[model samples]
Target: MKKILMQLKDYYGEYLLLIALAIVIGLIVGVVDAYFGMILLKITEIRSLSPFLWIPFLPLVGLFIVFMYQKYGKTSSQGMGLIFEVGQGENKVIPFRLIPFIIGGTWLTHLFGGSAGREGVAVQIGATVAHTLGNKLNLMKFQTLLIVIGMAAGFAGLFQTPIAATFFALEVMIAGKFIYPALIPALVASFVASTTSHFLGLEKFQVYLAEPFDFSLFHFLLLAIVGIIFGVVGSLFAKSLSILKSKMAMWFKNPYRRVFIIACGLSVLLLLLYQGRYAGLGTNLITASFSGQHIYSYDFILKLIFTVCTLAVGFQGGEVTPLFSIGATLGVVLANILHLPVTLFAALGYAAVFGSATNTLLAPILIGCEVFGFEHFPSFFIVCAFAYFFNFNQSIYGKQQILK
Candidate 1:
């Protein structure tokens, strides 16, 4: 007991320093996420106002985006891939330029009406900031822990869901592994960042959901069916994204021509189909799902296709927001079909689809509880569990590994 206490005493200073650094990370990342989220939302609103005017320029914007990356920020284009590499101990640095490149690229993609999401950009931004700080301070020995803390800060700042962000950062780097040591620092950073961003005017999307289903065997069975369906859709989304990215790369050969050509066709199709209904972050669909607005049976599938295609052609954005939108929209349809509460099922899909697509069960459950009410925690767990196991371990992030 004396020896253990001495050892703890010796290391306490280092641990305290790390905790202090986490506070700094949280504040910095929170500010960045707030600006990023606010601007992205503004961009989405701008595109919504005059879809035709902005969307027709998608091909030109795509060309510009490709040119910028190739010219000044080639390594930065790796985005989440670099974050994964650093976490996996395969690489040590994330280019500082990644911050500007991803944010700029995503803004342009949204401004010109591309179907995509913003969470990826936020995560990358957070990772880059933390990694840079760690490297400069010679904290490379704690690289994975720092990265996890940064991820949590970034995600929590944008979504204002600290617990979900903490677990997501902890578990997302490896399929079966959680960075236990990072838990304390990450949790602190997540809460701080979330509060900071909320203070900075980045709003969190939340809805109160009072569940109707008690934990009966019949309800469990019914939720299982819903979970299974969401899992299948999530897996399909991940698989389709991977295939499309590879196939498009092979077919185009030149990234410039690839993005431009695809963007041209995408521009026309986006214009033709509901006049850019499926464009941007799919937040519109998410809103429609929660509100009593009209959601067609096909809203989910169309959003899925558009989001997949947009990313496949090298558009800069995250898959997560669109995934949430896809899941929520699908949940509404599924609820109607299954004779369940539309809002409740929509909430379920909102969480489960994200869980399955990202292949992180804990994050989804926590996010569901955070965004909705904690009273639905049990339901979130059951649905997310079903979705996670049923997804076949597919992930939108190609670099994510299933630990053996």
Candidate 2:
């Protein structure tokens, strides 16, 4: 390694330092993600043991969560918005405290049966850790790059999809721009984080799916149609989230009252409807969509409404998993109507809807190939491309900047 570096006069120890930092950051975030995922799953399992016992207290939990944030959260409560502000250079500092605040808040949300996702927490965890490291090490010039690196590691650590994570972090800050220099560090961090989390016993969700029929012009056109449907649904989910967040804040005014009142209602609705079926990541819907476990036509719509409501009312979590659930369930219903194989269409939805909702093109396509199988790459590409085109540039991240 030293010999190679010596051969290039222009390049010296900077590359080595960057690589070392990426590896260190990845290792640290990977350990954090592994514990975060495990604790969350354990709490969710415990809650499922007696949802009636646990779920009724959602309003109280909501109050506690709000109080915790109000007391110790400070600017951390801005959540992903703070990360974005730093990424876009509008703000510079991401406090050291965001990591615990997000993780603890999300764990409590899941434990109390709030309908939410985990990816947002994962991304924020990564960004905060990496950004803190950069700040301490005086890597001010690469501050934005560190945020991207941390985001990739956090996502990869949680989902075990390094390729998709790298692209997601790279493309997420801007609609049509890429941070070219962060590519190597980001990739290194992602793979290391993914490997570390897997080694620590966090499981990655995967399914094997293939093209239902021979590829033909008819199939291609049909895929385009399906993609549009998923796109519209994804757009609706993103738009509704923004609207609900704004409207709820306007109406309630007080954070404590808002969370408590809404959570009381959500607890009853979540309990009454299928006994906590739409709560905590919507993995039930996703599993049912794939496993043929009696998914109703309204499953997607209800999950969408429940998740948007949960987040809008101050619950903590991410949106990507619920988006995945929505896509998968919607795909199941649509496939039945279109007379196509449910597995194939559901897989398409799992990826395409996420892409559409996040306004990310490559990440979803790559995630499809990674989580499902690369053999379905063409199908994923076709569906994800169409979905991206029809997304109308809506994103669950309120602070995302569209280059176009």
Top-lDDT candidate index: 1
Those runs of model 1 whose alpha carbons end farther than 4 Å from true positions after fitting are: 1-6
Query: Can you write out model 2's per-residue Cα lDDT over 242-270, one digit (the tens) per residue?
Result: 99999999999999999999999999999
Residue pairs in candidate 2 whose N, alpha carbon or C atoms collide under 3 angstroms: 117-318
Residues 263-289 of candidate 1 have per-residue lDDT tens digits of 998899899998999999999999999
- In model 1, the clashing pairs are none
Residue 172 of model 2 has an lDDT of 90
lDDT of candidate 1 at residue 157, scale 0 to 100: 92
Alpha-carbon error at 119 in model 1, in Å? 0.7
